[model samples]
Target chain A: MKKTIDTSGQACPKPVLMTKDALVENIDELVVVVDNPAAKENVSRFATKQGHTIKNIKDVGTKFEITILKGGNKEETEISAEEFNCAVLPSKGKTIFLSKNKVGEGDDELGQNLMKAFIYSLIEVKNTPSTIVFMNSAVRLCVEGAEALPNLQKLAESGVEMLVCGTCLNFFGIAEKLRVGNVSNMYDIATLLTSENTLTI
Target chain B: MEIVITFKLTHNAMKAKRKVLFDKLSAEIIPTPREISKECGFSLLFHDSTSEDVRDYLDTNELKFSKIYLRAVVEGERKYEENN
Candidate 1:
C-alpha cells in the first residue's frame, strides 16, 4: 500500500520533516505534497537522496505532488535533507527602477555618473530585490557598451530579473541592441512595481 | 574598503565623471541634495578613497562643470548615495 504525506500550507522545514517521517513508515510509495517551488525542490531532492526513487514530480503551481518509491540506490546525498533545517535561509526579494539616464535632475553629467554608482552598489546589496526595471533613457544603459552593463549583467546572472520597457527601446530605436534582461510591456510594469516595494530611479 | 569622496559642485562632478569614463571608475555623479537648499536636482557620488584621483582626473582633462556640496544619509541606509 502507498502512504501519503500532505505538507501543503506548511513551511519549508515542516514539509521536509513530514516527508521524512512518512518515509520511515512507508514501504513502497510515499506521496509528498508541498506548496511553493522552493519547498518542492528541496523535498524532492531530500527524498531522492534518501534511497527513495522519485517516480514522478507533478507541479501544481502553488503546490506539488511528488511520488517517491522506496529503497532505491541513488547517487545524490543527504545534504538535501539538511537544507531544511533551521539554519536554512529564507529567500529575499528585491526590485529597483532606473527611470532616467541620470539619477536626479540638476547637473546632467553628475546624474549620469550617480546612476552608474547606484547600479554598482546594488551588486553588494544583501538580500537583493528580485527585479530591476529600466525605462526612458535608462533603457539605453543596459544596451551594449553602456557603462552600467557589467553590473546589470552580473545581477541578472545572480537570479535578479532584468526588465526593460519595450516602448522605450522602440522610442530609442535600440531594441535589437539590448544586451541583457527581458522586454516587458505596460501591464507587466504596473504589476511589477505595484506588487512589490519598488525603488524608483 | 571603498574610500569616500565629495565634490564642491554637481556639474564639476559629472564633468569629472565624463572625463574619467561612464564606466570603469567606481565613482558616479549624484545630486547635491545636501549642498544646496534650493531645489536643483542631483549631485555626484564616488569612492571616498578615489576623491583625489577624481580631482586630478578632472584637472588633467580640463573639464568645467557645476559646484559640489555635502550630503549624508539623513534617512534610511543607502547603498551608495542618492541624488536627491
Candidate 2:
C-alpha cells in the first residue's frame, strides 16, 4: 500500500507532526512533498531515523518529493519514537558583536587579516549567527572602501542580519557610503545584545 | 558566473583584495572552494567576465596566487575549473 502526504507551505514541527501521524498508518511506502528546504531536510532526517529507507528524492522546481520504504523491526520504531521526542531542539538565538575592524590587539595588519578570515570562515559554516552587530571601527567594514564588504554582502544574502552603528558611521564621515546592512542606534544594539545569546569580538 | 582566485598565503590574499577594492573592481572574499587547494583559508571571487581586468591587475601588481578558476553551478553543486 502506498500513501502520499503534502506538507507544502507548512512551518517547522508542523511537517514533522504531520509526517509522524502518517507513519502511524502502517503504510508500506510513503511519499512526502515539502516546499521548503528546511522542511524537506527535516522530514528526510526524521524518516531515516524511523528506519525507513529513502528510496529516492526528486526535486521538482520549488518543491521536493521524498519516497520512503518501511521495513524496520518494531523495536526500531520504538527507538525512533523516543529519538523524535528529543530531536526537535529549539533554535539557538545567536548574535555576533564586532567592536573593532581588526580581530585582535597586536599587529594591525595581522589583526585585519584575521578579521577578514574570520568572516569568511563564519559564512562557510552550516549554522550561521542570526545577526552580526558592528560598532566603532567595525562600521568601516560595511562602507564602500572596506575589504570585507563582499563577504558581508554574501552573509546578508544568506539571511544573516547586519546591524551597523549609525553613530560610528557618522563619526567616521562615511554615512553615505554605508552599505550591506541597516544603520542602527545604541538603544537597538543594546536591546539585541542583552536579549539574545551574544558573542563579542 | 563567478571566478575564484586562490592565494599562496593569507596576507597575499588580503593584499590582492585591498588592491581590487582600491581599483574599484567588483570582488568578494569568500572561503576557498573545496575544489581548490591553497595555503590561505580565503579566496577572492568575482564575476567571470572580469577575468581580463583581474588578470591585468594581479599581474601588474605582482600579486602571488596559486590559481584562478571559473566557478559554475552544475546540478546544484558548485564546480570550479582552472582558468589559467
Best by DockQ: 2
Error of 2 at A94 (Å): 1.7
**Candidate 2 ranges beyond 4 A from true positions:** A1-86, B50-57
User: Deviation in angstroms for A83 in model 1?
Assistant: 21
* TM-scores vs. true structure, each candidate: 0.50, 0.61
TM-score of chain A of 2: 0.60
Across residues A15-41, which tens digit of lDDT does each residue of candidate 2 receive?
777877787787898899988777777
lDDT of 1 by residue, A121-169 (tens): 6777577778899889989998998878878898899899989999999
Clashes per candidate (backbone, < 3 Å): 27, 0
Docking class of 2: acceptable
lDDT of 2 by residue, B1-84 (tens): 687888878788888887876777777666676678644477888865556667777899998887878888999977988887
Q: Which stretches of candidate 1 lie over 4 Å from their true place?
A: A1-91, B1-13, B22-84
| lDDT per model vs. reference | 0.70, 0.82
Tens-digit lDDT track for model 1 on B35-54?
Answer: 34355433444545344465
The whole-model C-alpha lDDT of candidate 1 against the native structure comes to 0.70
